[model samples]
Target: MNTRIAALAALFLAAPALAEAPAMTVMPSPGCGCCHAWADLARAEGYDVSIRETDVAALKDDLGITPGHRSCHTALVGGYVLEGHVPFDAVARLLAAQPAIAGLAVPGMPSGSPGMGDDPDARYDVIAFGGTAGAGEVFHEAGR
Candidate 1:
């Protein structure tokens, strides 16, 4: 009985520590204000942000990222493409929920988004992309 209890306690303790945070490689054009702002936001949210200054257009093409999924930059997060100016909270939710999708995107720059920082109340959809590189679903709708 003591051994059984010890085993259970070990499992419980190791479970959370084993769930490491996903690493994000952010590729963006140099001197892009909004993109920088977006990366900063993600960093503030405790993401392991890696900024790679590169040709934005080429980076998108190389990663199979298209205009419909485009934003100010591109990010590879947890073995998935995180395109555009996505909110950090949304990214956190995706990693936690572990949904059936290829990637997450916030197409185009919205006014009130973290990167843009204009429309604090602007509405936008956090879209999930499927494995086939197509649109998935509205993962989250934002007003904040």
Candidate 2:
């Protein structure tokens, strides 16, 4: 009886840790301040983030991120690629939905985007790419 109680307590204690979100691996362009800021924001939002400085151009090319979809920083999480300063909510949606595509992108450093600045009026789209034809579609929109 005591053993059963201990087993139950252990399981309950471990449940939250087991359910934690997967770690995010971020590769930022060397010397890019915005990329570092974005990573900091992600960490503040409770994401388990790891950073690596690298040549972003080569990484983008290797990842098949089209020229139009390039960003200063790239991240890999839960088997999906995240390019640029994508908002945490967008990432959460992507993970929850697990859509059949390559990944999400916020494209260039748009003003008001995360790590860019707090521009309440900044408008941009989170683009989802690498589907059947490698075309991009709007995954989510932000800042009106």
Candidate 3:
């Protein structure tokens, strides 16, 4: 009975951490394997990812992912739009800080980016856009 009580206490202590993980819904272009790969990466990083195959172009437009900062997949998490293959760390930071920004984007797909095959040499910028239709501001640069 003491062991069982200890186990129950451990479970209760861990519940809050699990509950704090962000839930994300990703919309990827239909038949885009890379987008699927990206979504998988997000899941591995502990996000609750729900993927849907739809018209990504229309979705991007609707979400205000401007042409200059568009990618194959778009995700909604913590009330912010994440466009393209955004890095997991950036997402975590965004959620933790709850910045007043539109979202983060990787713009065009870079070879070394997550889900695009990690090519350590491939550098890319994660841009943060504010408001519903804000422009890109460099948030973080990877591989630098």
Candidate 4:
């Protein structure tokens, strides 16, 4: 009887820690409201989000985000870089799939993207970069 009680208590105590979501770090341009908005969006979606403000140009360069792949903000999640306002669902998918890629990028900020606005109909592509000589391919398409 005592053994059974101990087993049940152990399971209950470990449940919350096991169910905790992964953490995400976002580096956004200083004074960029949209970037903050996007961070809030990620937090709302169950990410343990942390935001840091920095020079966008220098940060982008440091992160190896070239001109074509540049965005207003950058994020690190599960060893992958998430550029711009990537959708929450796409992030969830990326973490679930655990693809062999550097990370996902949304490039420019689309009007209907997660932080830009709540437009479910907005069209965009989440790109996977850094796998093949720095070449990127589409990872997810919105409104498809």
* Best candidate according to lDDT: 2
Model 2 scores worst on lDDT over the 10 consecutive residues at 9-18
lDDT of 3 by residue, 33-87 (tens): 8888988888888877777666778667656667988888888776677888888
lDDT of 1 at 28: 75
For model 1, the local distance difference test gives: 0.68
State, as a TM-score between 0 and 1, how close model 3 is to the true structure. 0.80
**Off by more than 4 A, model 2:** 1-18, 133-135
Candidate 4 accuracy as lDDT: 0.74
**Candidate 3 deviant stretches above 4 angstroms:** 1-20, 132-135
Separate clash counts for every candidate: 2, 0, 0, 0
Instruction: Write down the TM-score for model 2.
Output: 0.82
**Which stretches of candidate 1 lie above 4 Å from their native place?**
1-21, 118-120, 132-134
Clashes of 2: 0
Q: For each candidate in turn, give its C-alpha RMSD to the true structure in angstroms.
A: 10.4, 10.5, 11.0, 11.0
Ten consecutive residues with minimal summed lDDT in candidate 4? 9-18
lDDT of 1 by residue, 6-47 (tens): 342242233232245445667776778888788888777776
Shift in Å, residue 4, candidate 1: 44
Query: Which tens-of-lDDT digit does each residue in 1-144 have in candidate 4?
Result: 123323422422332321266677778887789999999998888877776656668656655677887788988766667889999899888878877676788888889898898798999888887655334888889877
CA-lDDT, candidates in order:
0.68, 0.77, 0.73, 0.74
